[model samples]
Target: MAEITVDLIKELRERTGIGMGDCKKALVAAGGDIETAITNLRKAGMASAVKKEGRATNEGQIGFFEAKDCIALVEVNAETDFVVKNDRFQQFLTHVAEQAADTKPESLEAFLKQSYAKEKGMTVDEYRASIVQTIGENIQVKRLSIFPKKANHSYGIYTHLGGKICVVVDLEGASDEEKLAKDIAMHVAAASPLYVNAEQVPESVIEHEKEIVKSQIAGKPENVKDKIISGKIQAYCKENCLVEQPYIRDDKLTVAQFVAAKGKEEGKNLKVVSFIRWDVGQ
Candidate 1:
């Protein structure tokens, strides 16, 4: 058997544009012959898939998975909306989301190296490459996020526009109120709040808002400027903070007040801990 050296693997990778692991394996299987390895890769369609890798991937869907211990959201991108609607692409996205939820990989690179859950004898990235070859488009597992379940914490998940937009809200309370949590998640999807509350807003961000407010009220009296700035900041928080924003279902009550009212009915205290909102191509 021929020894498969680093240089040989590198040459194969340079020729194929495939992953190092795949390149090395191909080299070894071909007895360290770069031409033979390239032939094998081409026969398997991996080499051809490399041609589409550089294409723009601005259309795709978000995949959501919920497990007993954690929840996951994955954004997979493709070159066209037509590919996004393909059955195989949708299946691959679902499998990737489930993998993220099950494995809780710390990073996208780690996730790609994981074994594909629905397929045998293949890494996630390998499966993705095969899909690209089949679909004849650039496909990418863009990003993923996992949220671990916490005691006394319930999650509200809402998917909008058939997963073009997805939101997950973590709520802390004594009892699980799924409907309330989901309502908050829906509010998050619709309102697009950056923070859970006013206090969560960074001081730098507040200062920047103040600077904008000051410039807008430049001609105002000096004594009234401070009060006006304070008012403007307060309004900014109300609009940008999830809890402070008016509830989408009932504009009369702020999101925080709505949660509090629900808590009162449930005989427990409730608060929004954090949330994640994802928009496709964003």
Candidate 2:
């Protein structure tokens, strides 16, 4: 390795879309040549089998795994959402997730440490590295969410556009309604609701919205603050609240109103406890 220069680091970042630190390190090992740096990183990711570790990988796949009482939905991102459809990466994700069902690793590190029988005796991390070389982008396990079903509650899962996104919802007060469950799951998939209700949204998020609203009203008179605050709260609720969001089927009414009407007509009690959405390109 040689002494890496700022220009070399900048050039490598531009060429490979990798982070500055990684680019410089690669360049140092490659005698400060941009092309050599790219080759070095590629080889490193190959032997280690994982490249571009933690570089805002917003691409990959939405994987689904369901067990007796537990349902898991994951969003694995690569550098580009286009790679979400890559056969190699998708297969790797499916294999890893299926293995995750039986292997109870407390954290991702532990999970990676659990070896795979089909992996030619490579650790999970090594497997990931090999897969990344084939895919040629920074890959990350962006989101991993598990929903457990209680005796009274039920689970539903849905994915769209070949794993472009995934949605999982917990429906409470089940009444032997498989179709309704699927419908709610698909609704979650298509609508991509942020939160089930206003109460579920974190206070920090609410405070952030309030700050944005406050800034918008900065030039307004002091007497107008209360009115601005009230309007801003309404806006915040509208954006974050699932019920306040317009139904994807028909924008005439919000999901809350739609659900209420349907529940009334069906003579069934149903409540959405929580919802999760993972958008592939987002």
The residue pairs in collision within model 2 are: 49-129, 49-130, 50-129, 59-77, 59-78
Query: Candidate 1 on 1-282: residue-level lDDT in tens?
Result: 678988878877787788788888888888888888899999888899997898999998999999999999999999989999999999999889998998999999999988898988888988999999988999999999999989998888999998899999899985377778898999999899999988899999999999999999999998899999999999999999999998999999999899999899878899888999999998
Residue-level lDDT of model 2, residues 162-218, one tens digit each, is 778677767666635555556676877766667888888898987887788888888
Q: Where is the poorest 10-residue window by lDDT in model 1?
A: 173-182
How many clashing residue pairs, candidate 1?
0
Global lDDT scores for all candidate models: 0.91, 0.70
Model 1 pairs in collision? none
Where model 2 places Cα greater than 4 Å from the true spot, the runs are 1-58, 79-86, 132-143, 189-191, 211-224
The Cα error of candidate 2 at residue 170, in Å, is 1.3
Candidate 2, residue 69: lDDT = 64
The local lDDT score (0 to 100) that residue 64 gets in candidate 1 is 90
C-alpha positional error of residue 20 in candidate 2 after TM-score superposition, expressed in Å: 22
Which regions of candidate 1 fall more than 4 Å away from where they truly are?
Answer: 1-8
TM-score of 2: 0.68
